[model samples]
Every structure is written in C-alpha cells, then in structure tokens.
Target: MIKIRNPEQILSHGDAASRKLVLEIADLTLARLDSYRRIKSIGRMEGSLLHIGTRSWDLLKKRNVYLFGAGKACNHMAMAVDEILGDYLTEGLAIVKVAEETDAFRKTKVFVGGHPLPNEEGYRASKMMIDLVQKSGPEDLFIVVISGGSSALMSCPIEGISLQDEIDATDVLLKSGAGIYEINAVRRHISAMNGGMLAKRIQDVGAELIGFGISDAVGSPATGNIGTPYAAYKSTPIGPDPTTLDDARATIINRDLGERLPRSIVDYLMNAGPEGETPKSFPHNTYFLLNTLPDSCIYAKQICDEIGIPALIVSSFLEGESRDAGTFFASMAREIQTYGNPIKPPCVLLSSGEVTTLISDNSVIRGHGGPGQEMAASFAIAAAKAPGACLLSVDTEGTDGTTKVAGGITDSSSFQSASNKGISLFRALREHSCFEALDAIGDVVFTGNTGTNLCDLNIVYVPGIDG
Candidate 1:
C-alpha cells in the first residue's frame, strides 16, 4: 500500500500540498525511469546473446557491433547499452540536443546535436550513423536506439528540401496545433531516414539489424513508434505521384492539413506497394518490446489510492493539443467538484500522455515555451472558471522544453495572486508564459532531471467528502 503523501491536503493548502504532489509525481515518474534502465541491465550481451526462444546466438555473437542512438533519452539509453555491451560494442555513435560532455560510453563515439529543430551538426551526425550501418557486414550487428526527440536530432532532408524548409515546415506543423501522427507524417516525407527508408537501406545488407526503442507515442514498440525507418514506412501512405511543391501547398488550404497528412507521405507508406503485391514481412527474429507508459500510471494510481483519495486512472493514451486537453481535464475536475459523479469528492484523477503545442510565429522574437507549461497555464485558466478545483500538469522528465521547471500547479490562490500582482491570467496564457505566472505565485514544480521521460502526468483533486 504505497501512498502519495496527503493528496487532499496538497489540493487544499497551496504551499504544502502543491510541493508534496510535485515531489510525489517526480518520485513515481522516476520509478518508470528505473524500469527502463533495468531492461538494459538484464538484457546484457555476454559472449553471445540469444533471442527470446531461438537456438542461435550467432546473430549477436562475436560480431563487430555498431550503435546509433538519438533523442533526449538517447544519450542515457546509449550509456546503458555501452555499460551492458562493453567490448562487444565495436563502435558507437549518439546525437543529442543539449550538449553534455560525458565518459558514459567508454569505447563509443558520442556527438551532441540540436533538437526540436535540426542543425548542421545534427545533419552531419545523421550521415555518420547511416555510414556506420552501411559499413556493417554479414558478420556484424547494428543496434538503433531511439527515443522522443530523435525526429529532430536525426534529420536528413529529402531532395529539393533545405534544412531551413524542414525547420520552417516543422515549426508550422508544431504551432498549427496538430497531433503527433500528423506532424510526424509531414516529417517522414521530408526526412531521409524516416518512414521505413532507413530500414529499407539495411534490408539487403548482410548484417542483422535490430531496433531497440523507447516509445513516446500512444502505443508501445510499433513500427514508426520511435521514428524508425520501419515505422515511417508503415504509418505513412504513399501517394500515386510525388506531390509537387504547389500540390502540397494547395492541400493545406483545401484540407485541415493539421488533421490530415500530405499526399506524398501517404503515397510513400511502406505498406502500400504494387497492386496485389504482398508486402514483405518483417524478420522473424526482430523483437519490438512493449515497455512504456502503463507502469507509471499504475504506480501513480496506487499512491493516490493509498492517501485515502479516490483515484481514477484515466487513459494512458491521452493525446492531441495541449491547451485543449488542459481544458478537457479542467472540465472533468469541475464536474467531480460540482456534481460529484465521477468519483464523488476527495478524489484524484491521474493521467499520462504526450501533449503537443504549436510554436507561435512570434517565437522568432518572443520565443514560446514547452507543452507542459502551456498545459499548466491552460489548466489554471480552466480551473479558475471552476472555483474549487486543483490541478497539476508536468513533464515527468523534469526539464520541460528549454525551461528548468518540470511543470506548474494551479488552485484558487493562483488566480488571486495574479490579481494581486496586477497580471492578467489571459495575458500569460496568450504569451505561453505559464511558468512565469506560476513562479510569481510560488506554484512551479522543479524536480531537476529525474533522468527519464514517460510523457506527462496530470493529477486533479476535488476536496470534501460526498455521499
């Protein structure tokens, strides 16, 4: 009966309960991180490693192994693999956005690149990764480790597209309030290694290739779940013709491009080939593990229930626009408080999922913040609309985008403090500066790099006991 410390009190007393829930969520989030690390610890490579139930270990034994890992969690995942594989790792490479010098991979080469947007360094690193895999022979093994930010960290533009175009397009899709699937659809079309193109490249290569991924998407370990070449191909549809530049633009106005994907992307769908042509099946030996999201939600729910608060474990696959999702959750809080139908009073609604926000055009000059902060701000506005509800939204990874705070919390005092400071809550939301507003009122949650990412966790509590 592991319990979260006084969730009801945390909701009532802004100072104490706010801090407690923040720390509690951070602790639970770390548990998931530990689970991810444990997988690598137990799945270590000895002189030879065998698949779950295979007679042969030769596929992984005494081979020249090359590694390529990308994303915010990529560096950490790479570090774990390096520790487990050791001498068996003949050579390795990694690309990350925030550059941190580390001796984590003793024998592997490490490189830091930009994220959320690709830069020249990211391009160079991506090419190097492909070259490493290309060099592998039948006696070699290629291991690709991918995580959340890999799409940006491993960008290699398609022909006729410049890095700037890709960046601009990415900025548009992100700010367009599109979902992850839609955004990645456009990205797969423009990227060299995305949408299964990367897998196709090594399909005929003599060496065996295996992908180990950390899913930031709704489902776990599916094709394109981590932006691997296989996923890119499977998820996106290939159109009859490569969409011309003009055609792509026309589609934007005609369709809600944010909701619908581009024709070229659909055309290139790996599953779509010649008419009546059977698709090539993935290798029988390939393994895609389901290790994401669920553990964190279950643990968070346990803590809430133990604290004597009725807990509703909502969908682990929550997705879509950040602000809209915030509004929806805030509405749920209002219903629980006023109607007492969802779980009566004295209850916590817990949820985990990735939320996306559109980067504003003004970001060029004013710079917008991350999705977690936007969620916190939007939740506050919605909560303000309903007087007695308290809500907390945070990225489990501690750092939310470029900000140091994990996320923000909101209650009655949050609105009152805005009034006292002569600040308009609406203004803060418009500016995408929720962290600043929450900070002024002493409500921002900071956990300092919990060393893992499992999307976001949100908790809402309604006070008082209801019949």
Candidate 2:
C-alpha cells in the first residue's frame, strides 16, 4: 500500500544505518494498513452477530444498512468495512481527499474532495452525505468511517457562512500555527455536520450510527479531533480539544487569526447564528479505533528489538512548530552521543505526531511542502553536528498538504549534499519550498497513498554507540 520512490538513492545516499532505520520505519508504516489491521480489529459477520472492535451489532434483524463519511483515507477504511458487510450493506457514500483504493466498494459512491481547505466539490459531497444520513430510518444501521481531513472533505457550512467563508477560515488556520484541535473546534462550529450535529439528527429519527475512526491527530492515546463524524463531543474529548466557542476564542486571543483571516470568518466566530451547533447527546453509539501511530511505532520498535538494536519511543503525541520540532529531535540524537543518556547510541528514536507549519511567507506557493518536509529539512541542518545521526519524517497518509510526495528523509550529511549543489536549505525552508530543495538533493520520500491516515512518523537513527 506504501511505496517509497527512489529507494536505492534514498537508502544508499545516506548513512547506511539510517537507511536501514528508514527501511524499518517505511516497512512498519505499510504494515499497519487497514486491509491488514482490520482483520485483527474487526470480527467477521457470523449469521446474526457482526463484531467491530469490541462492539457487536445484530445485522440479521436490521433491514437498511447505509454507510457514509469523509476523510483522507476513508476510501480505504470504507472498502475494508464493505468487505465485512458484503451483501448486508445497502448503499454508501464517502468523500475523500485522495482516491487511494477502490476495492470492496461496489455499493458505495466515492467523491473526490479537497483538504487543508474545503472546496465546491467537498461542499457538494457533504450535502449528499447529509441526505444519506437524513434518509436513514429507525431500522437502518449506519456505519460511519471518519479519518483526518474529514472536517474539510465533509463540510457543509452552517447558515450565513458560505463555503468560500469556510475555505478562507481554514486557509488562515493552516497558516496560523493552529493545531488540529483548534482547527477542528472552529470547523465543528461552522460546519452543518460536525460536533455531533449529524448524530443528533440521526438520534432524533431513531436510527443507529456506529463509527470507526482512523486517527491522524496526534494519536498518543488519540487526542484532539476524533474525525468529527464519530459523534464528536459526546463526552469531553480525551485529547485536549476546546469547545467550539472556546476554540474560536482561543484562535482570536492567542493566535490573532481574527485579524489575519477574512472578515466573514471573524464575524461568524464572533456572532454564532441562531441555528448554532448545540448537538444533543449521542450516548449509545461508540467510536472504535482500528489502529494508531503509536501502534505503528511500537511495531517498528519490536522489529528493531528482534534485530538486537536498542530503540526508544520519544513521544507519540509530539506537536509544535515543524522547524523547531525537527531541531529538538536532532538534539535527542546529539544528547545520545554527548551524554550517553536516554538509551545511548546505536539506537533508534521513534516518535509520531502532527506538526504545524505556519506559512507566513507569501513569496512562494505556501502549498509546496507539508509539515514533514519542513521538519526533515530542519533536522538535516541541525543534525549536521552529529554525523552519526539520520532521520525520516513522513505523513502516514502519503501526500502532505498539496505535494504529491509523502515527506523526506535526511542524514547528518544531507546538508552537505544540498550545500555541494549550492542549494541553500534554509532559504527553501523560509520559502516553505522544502519539496523543491529536497527533491534536488534526492531526500524526498514518495509513498503514494498508504491507504491510511494515522499521523506523522518520525524516526532518528543514532549509530555510534552499538548495533
């Protein structure tokens, strides 16, 4: 499901040990695919009982079965679910940023949409999804698949807020250094289908809704946005998610998005419409986590352990500025060499989280690279001090933001490679065009849609102490 482009160049161009670590990280990232993990997580339908991640529904008695959702990888997740539901699935609808997979979905209609911001395509897709949900009856069982990018792919702006208004707001947030939680809070309030509003609509009509969430929002215990359609805000989120109002307030007070964004966005946040998103409780339905980024990292760690290498999980829920976070990760490698603390060298540092790139510079196309590339370029420059160090950063979903490439991998000598070519790494970083710079130096990682959206995967290899 995951393919690394220019593998020979990427693996052999850097420190061999870091290449192996990259191989391991890439291998494990593919290992956690929905096709593979779903078997272990979702039980098959046996006559009447259909088990899905600790929850079972009596499908034999149910009449209408509808499926609907939106996300980056919901297409693959929906396909996996379709295989299990088989003949029972009546009709389905889903909106996805990428059409990664198309199997096990003969009955489901997939709509291609946009991400990081909503577009007219997503606007139309969301209306179709709403219609599918609204038509569901008491006898119907709706299986909802929610993953990252759902907030945009499945958006239908509330009254007085146009689709363009929502799109402008999202663009501002993406560049405002706002995390997924903050972004989603504003999203849930502005969207006609978020913050459990969809669930409330279903519950009012007495239909059943069950969800499977493929988390991409810092899955250190899977915090922040629960992909929204899992009846978000049913209980206070385990992740540090602000309420719809609080998030708007925080964005204005903390990030100053009020002045940076369009006036329509500011006015909406300031004065909520009467048809505000105050979703009633959805107490019965449960959201199941099929797998997470931590699970992927741990699986990779197990492989390293079996191969007689010491490894450490730095943090599964890392967040902050992409460039800064990359430097801090390189620092961990430096510490292993200097102090011999935190599991020493000849070790692998594993972490998974979503970092933000606040693209304030307008000299270049802000969509040139994702957070992973920003972090990877920064790490390459910082780890120049530790020749024994190397790292790889990738968005598990494959494409990061607007780029076709997943992310990048770089060793300590990567900076030298760029310098030798007269490519100023910092200049590319400043322009938010790391993709162009990394591509020139052969450090870009290309995994064309792994058919999953967990989060970002970061692995730093320090190969001085032991093997």
Candidate 3:
C-alpha cells in the first residue's frame, strides 16, 4: 500500500541496491506512522458508546459530537475519526495541505489549506471553524486533531492585522533562519485561531474538548502510553501555547526581522500589552500524543533489525544549515567507510529533524528547492570521497520545502551524472535550486501525501570499501 510514484526512476541510476534498501525502509516507516491507522487502533465506536483510548463516552448523554482538525496530516486523522463516529457525529471539518482523490469522508468536509504560507481558503476555513465553535453549547463535545503545519494551515489573524500581514510575517520569520519554536512564538501571539485561541473559544462556550496531536518538535522524545490522556500537551490550536508575548518580541529582535517583517506584526507585538499573550494552559481539556520526532528513528531501526542490516541512529535532533549538514553527513560516511570509527561498512546512518535553508535575498533564488533537496545535492557533491555511498533525504510528510516531490536521493556518481547532463550542481546549490538539478538526473523522490508529518528523515548507506 505504501508506494513511491517514481521508484523506478530513482533506482535507474546511483547505487540501486542501496537505494532500494533505503526506499523500503522509508516506505515501511510511512506506512507504520500513518495517522489513520494510528487513530483507528485507539478509537472506535460500539453502538452508542464511543471509545478513544482508555476513555469511553456515551453519545446518548452528549448533545452533539463535533470534529475539527487542521494540519498537513489532517486528512487521515480527520477521516479516521469521521468514519469511527459515523452517524453519531454532528459534523466535521478538516483543513489539509493537500486533498487526495482517494480520501473518502462521510461526515467531514475537507478544505485544501495552504502550508508554509497562509492562503485565502485556509483563512476562510478558520473563520468557519470559529463560528462553528461559538454557536455550540455546553452539552457538545469537541474532538480536535492537530499536527505540524497547523500554524499556517489554520490562519485567522487577530483584530487590526490583515491576512496578508500574517503571510508576510511568516515569510520573514521562515527566511530569518529562526527555529520553529521561535517562529511559533511570533505567530502564536498574533493569531486568533492558533496558539490555543481556538481551544479557548471552545472552552468559553462550555464544550468538553478532547485533542489528539502529533509533535514534530526537534529533540522531542518518542511517545509513550499513547492511549493515556496527556495533560501537559502544549502549542497548536487545540492545546495551550507554551510561548509568550516576550518570546515573540525577542524573536523579531534577535533575528533582526523588525525591518524585514510586516510593519503591522512588529507594531502589534511591540505595542500590545499582556492581553496580547497567547493562552498558556488548558487544564480542562484532554490530550493524547500520537508520535514524536524520535519515533521515526525508532521505527527505522526496527526495520533495519528485521532486514539484518546494521543501523546506527546518528541523531534525532539534527538542525542548522541544510547544505552544511549534508556535507557533515558525507564526512561521517567517509569516516565510517575508511577508518571504521563509528561502525563498519554495509551499515546505515539514520537521522531525523528539521534542517533549514537560509534565503535572505529573494533574488538569489533561481528554481524550486527545499532543505531536503539541498541536503541530498550537497551530499552528492561531497559523497564522491566515499565510493558507492548513497544518501536519501525527505520530509516525512511527502513534500519537501516548496516542491511537490518528497525530496531527493543521490549517490557518489550523482556529481558525474550531473556533469554528463551539463547541469551544475554547485551552481544549483548557490542559487538555492537543487530540485531542478536532482530531477534532471532522475534523483527526485515522489510520494503524494505520505499520511504523516515528522519533519525530515535522512538516510545514508555506506557499503564496504571493497564492495
């Protein structure tokens, strides 16, 4: 069921054996981390009795059971709940980054929302959700599913701030090389829906809230006891925001984005008092953490164990400049293949986290690319030092940066391959356009809606020097 659209194209060149193995592991990981399957396993309904994890709710007592969700993985998460609730559900609305033709929903209305940048459709959906929550009463039960990208997917700016202003601010913050936490700090305080504002709206209406979320935060530990209700969950629209107004102001100042970002955002964060701070806690709501960043590595290692391949998890908190990280990974590959310091040959190096690309000048951009593409292209350039070493970098959610492709795959021969095609990989990197370079050599990965979002997953295969 887990299919890569361009597997043959990807394996046509490079270390086919190594590429095949990497693809297999990645596909299996995507299947295992599917939100629909995860939600179904813990949630179900037996007649009028609804069960989610350890808790069971009698629908006869509740007036209405409404569902709302927004994120990159919202489609699968919302679909699972809608199917489970069946006729007992009052209504459902899901704002997703992409809407697949195969996504069959009975009770949920799907909206294709914008990601990385707020769009008009998403803004309208956010307004609709706000109206829906406001009209509901105390007897209603609200079930919310949220994941990574919700900040952009669910966009409803506070009073006096236009949607374009929020979009402009997001662009500035993302390009500033600031981390997600810092970016969320500024975004949370300015949004009417984000940063627990939606949860607050539901809370004020006296409706019971139950939230399910996937944490894409770097350095997040693997989830445990997923069925148990978590009380300390924070961030996103449904949970309490851990960020504050001070954090927002600090990010703008620290990143020197005051002059670059929209004036409305900067002025609001500066002029607004304590009342502008996002809600910090929601004591009454119940939350569940499905998967974390480290879980991707854990699942990958399990695949390696089953296949009799030696795997070492380099790090789950990988960050910093994307190209630099690629070169560092290539160096590590060389060290392992030559010195045998970390581990022997015929081994795999696995890492997961958010690696960023800094694009301060918009004019420098020549073509489409993302952190994953840049990583693989940079690896291809440096990987020549270690023959036959192959690397695969992807945004686990199936889209990397601004492209439709999952990411890119490259090996030692990729540099020469590009040379043969008269494509300058170095120039491509310089212009922040690795997608065209990788695609020209049939190294681009394609998987539409991977059904999960866990930032980036990097895999490196180092064969024996003799092999």
Candidate 4:
C-alpha cells in the first residue's frame, strides 16, 4: 500500500496542503502503475508457469521465440520480460516513447518513438517489427507485448495514406471529440498494423504467437490490447471523401471525430469480423494480464473513504467524449449537492477510463494536447457550474495526452482565473487546450513519467452536502 497525503490537507489553501495533494496523487498514481508492473513481472516465463493453463505452458516451451513490445508501458514490460526470460529471449524488439539505456534494458533493442501521434521514428520502429514478423518461420515463436500507446507508437500507415495524412487525420479526430474506440477505428483503417492487422500478418508464420497485453481500453483484450480493427471501425465514420487537404482539415475542423470518422477507414472497418468475413487468421494463444481501471477506482474510493468522505465508485469502464463525460460527472456532483440522492455531501465520485477529444482543421496546424488534459479541463468546466465541487482528472501513467504532466484539477477558482485573464474556459476546451486553462490558474497536475499506464483516474469531491 502506498501512503498519500490527506486529501483534506492537500485541498487546503495552504501551499503545503496543495503541494501535498499533488504529491499524494502522484504517489497514488505511481503505486497503481507499480502494482501493474509487478503483475507483469510475475506473469513472466520463469515465474511459476504452474498456474497457467496447460496450453500456455506448452506454447512457452517452444524454441525460436521472437518478441515485440509496443506502447507507452512496453519498455517496462519488456524489461520485466528480460528479467524473467533472460537468455531464453532469442530476439526481441521494443518500441516505446521513452526508451533509455538503463541497465535493465541494455540487453534488448529498444527504439524510442512518438506517442499520441506517429512520427518518422515510430514508423521506422513499426516497420522493423513487421520485418521481424515476416522473417520468422514456422518453427519460431512470436511474443507481442502491447499496451495503451501501441496504436500511435506502432503506427504503420497503409498504402495510399501518407504518414502526414495519418498524422493530420489523427489530430483532427482527437480534437473532434471522438472516443478512443472511434479514434482508434480511424487509426486502424489507415494503418498497416492496427486493428488486429498485425496479428493477421503473422498468422501463417507457423510460429506460436503469444500476445501479452496490458489493456488500456475497456474489455475485449484483443480489441483493447492489440488494437481491434472492428472497434476502430465502430468509432470512425463512413463518409463522403474530402477533396483536398483543406477539405480534410475542414471536415475535422468543423465536425467532431466523435461525431464521425473518415469514410475510407469506416468502410474498411465495417467489413471486419466474422460476418464481414475478412481474414480469420490470428494468434491462437493470447493472454491479457490485467484490466486495471476497476482496481484503481476501488483504491480511489478507499482513499476517499479513509479521509472521511463518502466515495462512490461510479464505473471503472467509463468512456465516451471528454466533454460529455465531464458534464455527466458534473451533473452527478450537482445532483448530490441539490438532492443528496446517490451520494450525500462531503463525498467523492470516482471513475476510470479513457476519454477522447476531436480536432478540426482550424487548429490542426497548432494543436497540442492529449486525452487526460482534455478530460481534466472538461471536468473543470463542468465543475465550474456546480459550486462547491472540486474535481481532479489524471492519467496514471504520468503523461496525459502528449504533455509531460499527468492532468489537472479544478475548483471554483479555475473559472474565475480564466475569466479574469480574458480566457474562456469553454473556448480553450473547444480547441482541446486544457493545459492553457489549467496553467493559467496553477491547476495543472505534473507527475513526470510514472512507469505505469493503467488508465485515467477522476475524482470529484463535493463538499458539505451530506449533512
């Protein structure tokens, strides 16, 4: 168990309390990440295969193992595998946003790349992974490690789509307020490796493919872990083609990706699954280590309760548009304050999951933000209308969206600060610019790269409504 400073102390106006709250949230988030890390460690090859199903053990014993790890958490997961598998790791490749020359990772090939957006480096690393898969024969074993950021970090745009096209499309979709499923759906359609396409590519290599996934999405590990083409399709849109780059930008600028995804991506997505009957080839053996949001929510609830606040565990799998989700949570807080129904006053409402933002053409050239910040800012806007309510949203991974900070917190003062500065919180949110809003009020929550990625954590504290 990790100890966090009392929420009350942190919420206090004193600098010590404020700093303590930030530190405590950071600590709690890190602890959650660490717990997941431990699970990955224990699930390694040498760590008691006895508990695993017989089929998994049989697959493990096979030789000629080739490994690939992708996503934000991939570096740590790969390092843990190295610790456990040691010399048995015949050959492996890891793609992460932050790969360092640490002692634990010295033995493996680690490629540092971009996240939330695919860069040239990310594309290069992804191509290397594809090459590795293509080289493997029937006798080889392929181990693919996947986590949250894999969709962006392992990006390989398909034919007819330039890397810039994909990047531009991604930027639009993000600000367009699309959910993760929708954003990823568009991503899968445009990519060579997403939407279980990677799994399909190596299906016939005769190698026993073992996928170890740290699910950042909701359930459906294959979909959540490796990027399901179907889910991505579900999230994207079937539409009229955009004639020019300007048109494409306009489509994204005026419309929400949440409202619709690219027609090309959507069409390809619709043709997936058994009914659509594309390729049926996939890894026979796959394992998902943890779907962690539930546990994190439980932890948050316990912490809130310990602090003498009634805490409600609303849902661990919260999803949908960032602004809507924020509004929904805000409504809950409002309800408690007005009616005291679901939860009384002096209570907390906690949720975990991924929220998405959509981008349009106007800001595509100047856009910079991620989901966590969007969620925090959206919640802040919502909380602004509900007096006496304070909310905090963060990405447990310590990196929210593309920024260095995890997320932000909001109180009544957040709105006042923005108003005084001639900044409209709503306008900032429309641009998916939470950092600006939070920064203006000194509300940004900064926790540098916490080695774990479970999902987002949201806590809404409603004061003095219970009694």
lDDT of 1 by residue, 149-248 (tens): 6777778876556777666666666667666665665576567765555555556466666666555566543222221223321221110112233333
Model 4: per-residue Cα lDDT over 153-222, one tens digit each: 8878876667776776676666665566545545655567776667666675666555655556564322
Give the worst 10-residue stretch by lDDT in candidate 1: 232-241
Please write out the lDDT profile of model 2 over residues 1-467, one tens digit for every residue. Answer: 13565687686676876776666666665655543355335547877788765457888778888878677777677877777788888888878787754344778888878887788887887787678767768887877777777777877878788888888888878887788777777777776776666666667678887777665656435433332234442311111133557566676778777777667767877777545645545667767665566766776677777777888988888898889988998888888888887877778888888888877755566338888998999999999988758888888888876698888888888999999999988988888889999988888888775667877888888878343
Point to the candidate with the largest lDDT.
3
Question: lDDT of all predictions, in order shown?
Answer: 0.60, 0.74, 0.91, 0.61
Give the TM-score of each candidate: 0.79, 0.90, 0.99, 0.76
Q: Kindly indicate the candidate among 1 and 2 with the higher lDDT.
A: 2
Off by over 4 Å in 2: 1-6, 33-36, 101-104, 219-242, 273-275, 364-367, 465-467
Task: Judging by TM-score, tell me the better candidate of 3 and 4.
Answer: 3
Task: Supply the global lDDT for candidate 4.
Answer: 0.61
RMSD of each: 6.3, 3.7, 0.9, 6.9
Show where candidate 1 strays beyond 4 Å.
Answer: 1-13, 47-60, 99-103, 219-281, 306-308, 358-367, 384-388, 401-404, 447-451, 465-467
lDDT of 1 at 249: 38
